[model samples]
Target: MPRRYLFYVEQNYCYGILRPIQNVLRSRGDEVAWLPVGDAFDRGGFEAGERVFDHVREAIAWSPCAVMVPGNFVPGFIPGIKVMVTHGLISEKRRKKDGVIYSFIERGLFDLYITHGPNTTTRWRQMADEAGYFEVAECGWPKLDPLFDGSLRRNASAGPVIYFASTFSPRLAAAPRLFDTVARLVAERDWQWRIQFHPKMPAAVTDRYRALSGDRLRVVDGHDTLQLLLDADVMLCDTSSIISEFALLQKPVVTYRNLSPRPYMIDVREPSAVGPALARALQRPPEVMRAVAEHARETHPWTDGRSSERVIEATDRLVESGLGHLRPKPRNRIRHWKMRRALRYYRLFPTR
Candidate 1:
């Protein structure tokens, strides 16, 4: 019998992380349904196996065997087992009061955690030991499989493609501070520029970059950035995990005032230094490539592209062994209220 699975998509852009797993499950005769948690489906225009439901009530009624999410919160009231697959590589960006990479695990909301590498798996195992609620699986990230499998590769003749990406946070974002400098560099060098923003980035910030788009520069709003990563020759970013992702490609990366500095990347304190740093990176590929290799090994250990298969196998073993049937942790009223408010603001659930 095929196990029925529910995949929650809180952001349309999360498809990049969840799609590979979904495809693997389906190929093995499991049924997967995509549940759009907010206005993400409408904005992202995602198509899936069944009718998309905007309300949690409808999803809970379906009684799936397991529910998988890439985001932080999942409704505990639902009978299905809640599985958390990370939305991105664990960057050094802090999102919690304790300076943790994310707030997802602190609440004990998930039954299973699918981690990207040993670094993340070790942290998650420590958390699981403390919480005594979730199980941890160290499957490599599913999204990067294409890059390793040769299905995706950079166009060598793409005319010096420069990818500029930013996080949504005001404190760490380079888009607001470096757009003009980037625009000038693109025009001056006649380089092909690709600018991509985080889905949560403020409309005003995206608008500013969109205005810089021209014959040489393209402003991309797609949910999946893997293609963009494969297309670019060099990457310009702030504190985004895209820096880690691009570094895995063994390419030069320039960071403008990065909140967290790594030995592998060229960090510039001022926007004026971006062009010079990019020039140095391009001119000195051997030095940068060595650093890129070290960064890639430390961040992601698996480059064989079998992460999605490992994830599916882990999920299947848990389900078949009935370990996924463990009761969800007791609900926290305060957290539920906050989540409801956020959903209502996004028009995903009713106000009442």
Candidate 2:
């Protein structure tokens, strides 16, 4: 029998991580089903619900393994082998205002935490240890598909681009500050810049960027970020895993997390210590291209772009082992309650 998966996807936002994994899983003969938390969140008009928790519980009961994308409503009651493949392994340097809802997940509910690099695993392990549970692994970043192959290409327009691939967080104030500076710096230049904001970010910020609309300063929404990075001449970001993709392209990438903690992440080969060393790289990025190249190799020792293969291998191993005991369920039932609900939906909404 083929392997079955009940994957939880929080729509729009987790496309980068979930989409690639879905393709790989299906290609490997796994029957995959999606429970879109994004759709659920929207349906509730952004309000929280027990339905979200109930859906996750159902998915876990049906499949031996369930991948829960972070930022969705996590299952508080289910204590199965909840595996977390982080959307992007980011540093705590730039804290979001909403103290990571899932931070407390370390409390004995999860079994494995897959991370892109050792640095991230180390940090999370400490957090998990503090929470009294410790099981973390470095499986590399599976979503960085473009980096593994030279499949992505630059845009047809051939216009110079400044890609803004970051979500606005108050902790990393340097990011917005640098963005404004770059906007002012490039406002007069002949080149064009595109700003891509995080989905949850308020429209007001995007509107502020739009006001600076010189032919060069353009505010855009919903562009394929991977394609944008591939096409752009230079990328300016802060502590976002997008840099890992940029490293694979071997492009000129400058980071703006100067005020944040020494960002320990995957593919950040070079030490981003402050003063002349960091400033010079930002000012003249091409000059440090060689250093970035050398450091990327050291930082991502296994990052030859075969993350998808590794993930595939890991899943295959799980299947072979008959899936470590299914995510826990209420003892009285054979089939999970959510599966029953989903069947009802299929029967009623069959054509629609």
Q: Give the residue spans of candidate 2 off by over 4 A.
A: 38-61, 68-73, 76-80, 92-107, 121-135, 156-159, 174-183, 238-245, 261-287, 302-304, 319-352
For every model in order, what is the number of clashing pairs? 0, 3
lDDT of 2 by residue, 141-172 (tens): 66667645666665764456666566566554
Candidate 2, clashing residue pairs? 80-327, 80-328, 269-295
> lDDT by residue for model 1 over 1-352, one digit each (tens)?
8877888887775677777877777788887777776655553466645446666666677778888888888866555667887888877777667766662346767778888876677878897777666788988888888888887766664477888898888888899888789778877996888898877888987887788778788899777788888988889998887788888888889998887788789999998999989888877568768888888776788999889898777776776676544544656767766776765532332211
Q: How far is candidate 1 from the true structure (C-alpha RMSD, Å)?
A: 4.0
Task: Give me the overall lDDT of model 2.
Answer: 0.52
List the candidates' TM-scores in order. Answer: 0.88, 0.67
User: Which stretches of candidate 1 lie above 4 Å from their native place?
Assistant: 40-44, 48-51, 103-105, 156-158, 200-204, 324-330, 337-352
Residue-pair clash count for candidate 1: 0
Which candidate number would show the highest lDDT if scored against the true structure? Answer: 1
lDDT of 1: 0.78
Q: After superposition, how far is residue 190 of candidate 2 from its true place, in Å?
A: 2.5
How displaced is residue 178 in candidate 1, in Å?
A: 1.4
**Cα misplacement distance, residue 322 of candidate 1 (Å):** 3.1
